[model samples]
Target chain A: MAGSELTNIKSPRVKAARRLTKRAFRDRDRSFLAEGPQAVREALALDGVVVELFATAEAETRHADLVAAATAAGVPLLRASGEVMAELAQTVTPQGLLAVCRFVHVPLETAVTPGSTLVAVLAHVRDPGNAGTVLRTADAAGADAVVFTDASVDPYNGKCVRASAGSLFHLPVTTGAGAGRVAQHLKDSGLRVLAADGAGELTLDDVDLSGPTAWIFGNEAWGLPEDILALADEVVRVPIHGRAESLNLATAAAVCLYASARSQRTAPAGVRRPAPAG
Target chain B: MAGSELTNIKSPRVKAARRLTKRAFRDRDRSFLAEGPQAVREALALDGVVVELFATAEAETRHADLVAAATAAGVPLLRASGEVMAELAQTVTPQGLLAVCRFVHVPLETAVTPGSTLVAVLAHVRDPGNAGTVLRTADAAGADAVVFTDASVDPYNGKCVRASAGSLFHLPVTTGAGAGRVAQHLKDSGLRVLAADGAGELTLDDVDLSGPTAWIFGNEAWGLPEDILALADEVVRVPIHGRAESLNLATAAAVCLYASARSQRTAPAGVRRPAPAG
Candidate 1:
């Protein structure tokens, strides 16, 4: 194996790192961007994470343990100059290190365990940042899964990936067609489907979230679609006690998911029902 | 008072509106930016809003009732073209409507209600979006005030303003120096000060948040400073069940504030602390 030190701009290793700026390179090459020490650490910690790791000479010396772990995992390493590293990096201050991680597809089915008490379904959420933050919150609240419905932002978008803070790797997330179908399936499977809306009939505090359930968060611009709302057994809302017309979409999702998690915690343990006669 | 329609490209009114893109214009004029029908409705609903209301001819016609209300409230009105409106708009899709609102200065002393049971003291949070969302969440969770100590984003920055939805209007927020001194004062006034940290000894859910209290949220990059942490009677954290390193600053604030609110709700009516005593 060639232990190439990429000193020049034209080096093939340096050129490959620069391609991460474009989506085509990220998709066609099946490699994506991860920046900053914390993010790089997260990517390193995950199994099957590194395809190619890049760092400036200074970062290589400073984060020797990190580089060693990647090398031990049989990952290819690229050393670039600080200037080159900065050019290849996404964030303003790159910390002189980055990684091109192989994207792992999260499974759609079985993402939510049958015994899980709460799941979050995002429908037509266009903003990747909002979608990713919701996924992170769901992970924080220990929700079983996050389901992305039709027309939603791709969870794999760079901004979304960064926003998830690697929670994307931890949570069971299902993205694809027919989120409505999944909602129906959860309902038929005996999970309560609660849709979140500003004009919802019941406040989130007023809803019973102790049972197996799915909470739906909709588009930041439009709130939930009528079809999704119709599928909901009950509609719940985060009470707006102040003059803010609406909370940001991500904030709203965090509050609802946390509230549901709290509700479940406070409820009697035996309240969870057995799976409805298969 | 000339009745001539204000349609010309170089009209003084149109030129003045265009100047709002400069912060000095926004400040010196004692007016800031607001747009879209929804934002306008919330602003109009709030007291002490809208010094000047600007809209395209079509917007004025489409929202005649709103226009009438603005005129009745003695707000100055300007008519501009869609192209002209975009000059003052922050978003990509200009709503063909905008409002120049008077900046409301909330006094810190007044914001700290005489007998409030809970509030949030933000220390050195620099992100405008994070700061504004914190204020909005504090409002939703029914906290008395959001206090900023030391260097932090201006709570009224356009991005912060937009992020707050209309919460900026309703919530009592005061910013200035001596946050630590004020926090100590809060403790002396019989309020518990809970500081959130990633490695805190106590879990947020385990803390007794039902008492009169002021929760402090710190900068996103460094968490709370040691000096500020020293003032906290209790340091608590939201236990992370996933691999994500930490929750977003606003999301963390919401979770903490809501947990406190939840405990207050579940407490025996008599056991909960009375409003803070002056």
Candidate 2:
């Protein structure tokens, strides 16, 4: 049912949606805000839970397709005032539409189970933008899943969601797993956990990526710690042929994931070629 | 020479540095601000003009190497108060160091001269962060130069500089070129002009990138216009094997440039294989 126009900024529904901006409130409710037309549209199409959607009259007209989709799905759609929409939005320029979506991340066991050929693991990645970009890149590279260690930034953060640009809804993401636990789970499952480090002895060009692999990237500033590095089966560095000091976390992850994706795609079917020894 | 401690934010030197935060001031003075130890250190090492340097006491102690470099270069290094540094920095968390660097961009003719091998041209790219990230990627790929069309964001923007990390100093950059002129100049210089478009007929995987090439990328929102796409020798799109709606400006550019870099590196020496006919 369509709710009455929510004019008051402090109305119960508006306030509830606004509270989702806080991590604690999102965790308690198991919901996060997916703002903008692109994100809201994607969330509405997913099989995951989309509790409610809010839009201003302007948005109702501008995003008529999304509104039609919500109505077709029999989901509750609320008409809100500009002030209420702004109050619910984290960005300075709100995109007029926002959806309250339940956490869609799967368990680590489900994400890294057998037959998962490629995965991305972020360890202590503090920047929300970098974390989100990595998720988007991994999805584009067709990685089976992405995992975030407990030390990493919250994937559900508003900025992180914005950076993902709708890819967050396209793939399964597992979060809050311990670095060591993830390494062990992947290894036991027969996947090689390769840590991306600048000082690694093995270069990416020299490493064979034909086998199942889990790429572990680290914090934006400090990169992977020694303890975390020790947990991986191998450590590899992207070759720096130019004078650039190093690639940032997101770009580095993109190159590494794409490399693996290309290798896996071109490898002959049913022939398990051994990876070159580091 | 070390200037006296600049405690007063209103002092002429400090005020001039602060004004550099504005585009008008930067363009008028032909100077831009390079902040943080990494950028400042790079600027000091380059042949580009370093008009002045400023650091807080904490930064002086923390970045003793930079101080010594400036001292050896015979450049004036002013000691400023934290207040002064903060006022001069655009970032919320100032890095305690800043450098006034004269514009180092070359002309289009100079950037894409006869011997140039690989280059990236951005056509009407509006986002400063995207433009900066592309510049860094191009540098890392060992592209000879990067050219920004007049419609693109200013390379000297503080946000753009920060996104480039230290790459803005690593290679020659050119700005204010028209898309048509860049396409023609590159073509005349024996470089193939390839435009990256989502709707392109040619896939990046199928195209041969073994020769000198100039890659043309478009705006973040509306991609290259039909006229701009027609100007190129061929229009190519990165194959999206996954369900991503589309790659962002930066990630797409990285994939394309790295593809070229890899191809050029692997091609046999002294053999110029003709690219597939567009």
Candidate 3:
């Protein structure tokens, strides 16, 4: 392996890693590719899902720590040429490194149990970028978990994995669950379920967000379907005090989650916690 | 006009409208294209900037209100076939409608003035999508204006225009000015200048934002230069409560701006307003 480097894009291992770029293939293999240094480092830090890493000689030199970490964790690090690495990474300017990892999402029960403090649920979110951004936002807010409902995009989609930065590996995620089930779980776990919708009667400012809460975000275009909105205990909207019509999904989610984090952190007592219905 | 549908993508007028898709051509022609129904409607609503409209027959029927709006505003509406419309719009699924409009950025002095409450400045922000999303976030936060510095991406770039939703037309925007001049303008206008950075010594939570303020946001990859950061009265970071390394540009901007909105709205006795420096 000293003088030899993988140069053929169609080489068996290279082809195998490239296949993970497609959603159907990813699902079949239960694996996906994490591109760039940040994502690869985070996946390696997991020390579990990462099966192997492909790096150009330049990337190997640039990311020696990642190579050492992978080595210490018993993960194989393959050396590839620029062309081979480009074939494995989706970005226009390939970062010359990538990781093949098992799906990062866990089962719904394993993601968040009873009495969870903060949560974000993607209900019918279709855009890969939006889904990933929301996940990153949730993680930054210290959310216990993020739920990608049946109608949401695959978390392992190449664009999403990149958009999430390293946050994809930072927190627990539950995917392919139904929105109704997610809402019920949050409610049963003693958290108030809030559907974030543009047409919601209550603005985000109107709520006491210090409570243990799970927020359900809807489709980028049409927003949450009526049934899903009904499952939430309350429908809340991020206030738009200007002439703009509405906030995009990720910004809206951030405003909502950050409000919850600030409020929950500064609450004078436990008084803002939600009470069960009679 | 009912039978005069433009079916050829390269026909004189069609090609002219299509040319706006390229930034150089747009600048030379002093025009840009706003795609999709939401953007087209908003452009028509401006009663200015809009030079003409291109539509497929199906779109004219589907967007009857938009057609009526354009007709009533005396803006020229040209019918095109779906294929021609696709050529004129960059989206994979074109909405079959778009607007040819002049550049939208206003002169700097006219965008904001003394006593302006909230403002956002883009310094060295190169990504068109990020720039547009920040513009939209600022709009939703009811910011007085958005300034795109000389180093920032052009606001008329197709992706930026689309990402801005309709916010491009909702409020005043200043573009192509130097960041230093913009910061000085904000200071002279009696507003606090805050730079949002990941490594700022002051977290957003540490400052009182209930006052007239202007925020300078840096590049997606590198952030602000030392000279630019030094120009700010206070450098601020949105607190990351969890394991995420950092928030994306748009989400961070939203968190900061919304915090200011909430603080300024709820401030009593105007006590949080900043005092002039010695």
Candidate 4:
């Protein structure tokens, strides 16, 4: 509401939005792009998370509710030309809405406090799409947080932000930590750290997931190395019951996290179903 | 081994391979392209599936074992130039090998026999990646087969083939059929037909997945239409216990199919854990 119509694509505000596309600029500004109406709406819902809102004149009329909500939330809404919006947005057909939001991730120490029932740890995950899907899956499963090891893809990457489908705004995500340190931290917080590997000794069904647990996933191409696998309390695999070689990273994470979610929701207190007979 | 070196990118074999990139060409020829060593290797393992194998001269030396296997299998292995190979491949850096395989999908009737315990039905799924991932997930879960309804993307699309990770060769996939017809056929096979919807009366946990079942998944954007959801015996939602709105199509399919796989594997015949009290 305070900002004028930003028609020039080279304007500082538009340039800033474009800069957020790179990891260096995002880290420096501690802000990232949340594009499309759904993502922007979700970001606006989070108090103080949305720093600035940009909408093309058409988008303002099309998403009147979102514009009104952003205005009511005291977010500075900047009107931009279609060309300016297109320059700032990633999609082939720009959705006409973009939000610059402060990094919503909390410190790992604060997120993994006691009573953290479920968490997802991604180690050396290089694909932004997989990383984002895992984050979305983790959020859907009610995980307390997600931690990306130092070698993982930037969780704020444009493709990742798009793949997350707005779930990135729903939960705390931590990045740039070592797998060993993250594993130790989770274990220190009284959570069982389980590494998901293709060749694990125990099947996912064999694990007791009702207690506080940290599910560790690895890279898409090459999975967790031996050293990282050793950091977990146990290594488990989602059983490949058929001829297919393996599940994709995100699907594997979904199965693992949902299994834990189902178990924790059903099992009474610390009691869980015994591992099924092989 | 019998074919001479093909240095020209305009050779008939290379032209045919290039044409397979289009759906119309693939359908008319009833052949699809399988790129990379893993996919080519898997294609060779299936007797008579690999019609023609092409490799760069450098690839021939690198993949001696594959060449030997193909030679022993009596498949015509054509040697091509790097330029020809690059033109044939979709990747920025071609893997140096490609295979033309006849469509391996079988008749839906044969796939949905009475003995079939688990199957995946995808209706109106437009994303080639999501469709392929679902196929891979179904295969990994040991489902009997996967069926893509009429509106679905061609399962043989290059992106779909890549996302399937060779699982496309592992199981029978049926396509170009109506959703209603597929649903009716599955029901007639004495399998419980369950439609997966984000908004459904029953959660996936409440369903009896231990029995023979056909799980139906909808499109990536707009989910299953009302008519399709109405055709199923029951509509079940994967429980979203967190703030995330919904699971991606592929992840939702993995969760559903694996739930069925785990249930069918763990539960005794006609006996399963009672639905957890919610």
Chain A superposition TM-score per model: 0.89, 0.95, 0.96, 0.94
Greater TM-score among 1 and 2 belongs to 2
Q: Taking the true A–B contacts (Cα pairs closer than 8 Å), what share appears in each candidate?
A: 0.62, 0.56, 0.86, 0.87
Give candidate 1's TM-score. 0.86
lDDT of candidate 3?
0.88
- Candidate 2 vs candidate 3, TM-score winner: 2
Please, what are the lDDT tens digits per residue for candidate 3 over residues A1-278? Answer: 32379899988999999988888899999999999899988898775889988888998889888888888888888999988987888889998788899888889988877757899999899999999999999999989999999989999999988889888899999999888788887887788999999999999879888889999998867988999989989999988999888889999999999999998888888666654553
Backbone collisions counted per model: 2, 0, 0, 1
| Runs of candidate 1 exceeding 4 Å displacement | A1-31, A80-88, A184-190, A266-268, A275-278, B1-31, B35-40, B45-49, B81-87, B184-190, B276-278
Ordered list by TM-score, greatest first? 4, 2, 3, 1
lDDT of 3 by residue, B1-278 (tens): 34488888889998888878787898899899999999987888776778888888889999988888887777888999988988888999998889899888788888978758899999988999999999999999999999999989999999999999989998999988898888888888888999999999998889989889999999866878998999999989988988999898889999999999998888897565654553
* Stretches of model 4 off by over 4 angstroms after superposition: A2-4, A270-278, B2-4, B270-278
How far residue A256's Cα lies from its native spot in candidate 4, in Å, is 0.3
Deviating ranges (above 4 Å) for candidate 3: A1-4, A272-278, B272-278
Output the chain A TM-score of model 1: 0.89
Task: Kindly list the per-residue Cα lDDT of model 2 for residues B1-278, writing each as its tens digit.
Answer: 56678999999999999999898999999999999998998898886478888989889999999988887887789999999998999899987889999998989998887677789998989898899899998998899999999888899999999999888998989998788888888887778899998888998877889898899999867889988998998999876767777778888898888888888887899655443333
Per-residue alpha-carbon lDDT of model 4 for A104-183, expressed as tens digits?
88788987866688999989888998999999999999999989889888888988988888988888888888887898
- Candidate 2 lDDT over A1-278, as tens digits, reads 46678989988888888888888998899899999998998898886567889989889999898899888887789998888888989889998899999998889989887678889998999999888898888888888889989999888899899989888898889998898899998887678899998888997777889889999999767979999999988899877767788878888888888888878887888654443332
lDDT, each prediction: 0.77, 0.87, 0.88, 0.88
Worst 10 residues of 4 chain A by lDDT: A269-278
The DockQ-derived docking category for candidate 2 is medium
Residue A118 shift from truth in candidate 2, angstroms: 1.7
Q: Residue by residue across B1-278, what tens digits does model 4's lDDT show?
A: 64678888887778988999999999999999999898998888899999888988888999999989998988888888888888888888888889999998888898777778899998988999898899889999999999988888998999899888898888888888898889888877778899999988999889878888899999867888999999999999999988888999999999999999999898885574332222
